[model samples]
Target: MKLRELRIEKGITHKQLSDDIGVPVRTISRWEKGESDMLLKNAIKLAEYFEVTLDEFINF
Candidate 1:
């Protein structure tokens, strides 16, 4: 899924969510821009933080 959708659906800003999950804001931007892939650890953290499954996060 696209980062824009995830961020909007989770009601979080890139900076805020990244900070909450101990990642860099730039990395989040890269993910949004398709410049990087999500790491499994970060994906798990995001799912927990957003109360979603990895499939949901990936919008599968």
Candidate 2:
């Protein structure tokens, strides 16, 4: 799933996700908009936080 999709499905706001992942909401916004790439560390953190696999994040 896309970042936005995962965020929504997990009932997490941009700010919440950012706080959880130690990033700014604007960064999350960029991610959702496909304007930036997910680095390896952040991607792993996001996957772990969402209880999803890296493949789920990447394959979407």
Candidate 3:
């Protein structure tokens, strides 16, 4: 997933993202690390947060 890349590009820490999006920091970490799958709702939230389409968020 492009989670880590996008987060870095946006210059935001995982904690900052978690606080803004109401996700747990660990969950964000897991998603970034490919250790777990994000729920669709959470994925949508992230896509919206990053201002990207879902396909770009997940695959680009």
Query: Highest lDDT among the candidates is held by which one?
Result: 3
Which order, best to worst by lDDT? 3, 2, 1
lDDT of 2 by residue, 1-60 (tens): 488898898898998888877899999999889899878989889888888899987876
Q: Which 10 consecutive residues of model 1 have the lowest summed lDDT?
A: 1-10
- Across 1-60, the per-residue lDDT of candidate 1 in tens digits comes to 666786887688988988898999999889889899988888878777777788887783
Residue pairs with clashing backbones, model 2: none
Give me the displacement of residue 40 in model 3, in angstroms. 0.5
Candidates 2 and 3 compared: the better one by TM-score is 3
**Structural RMSD, model 1:** 1.5
12 in model 2: Cα distance from truth in Å? Answer: 0.7
Which 10-residue span in candidate 2 carries the lowest summed lDDT?
51-60
Q: Please provide TM-scores, in order, for all candidate models, with all chains considered together.
A: 0.81, 0.91, 0.93
Instruction: Sort every candidate by TM-score, greatest first.
Output: 3, 2, 1
Candidate 2 local distance difference test against the native:
0.86
Instruction: List ranges where model 2 is wrong by over 4 Å.
Output: none
lDDT of 3 by residue, 25-47 (tens): 99999988889998999888999
Pairwise TM-score winner, candidates 1 and 3: 3
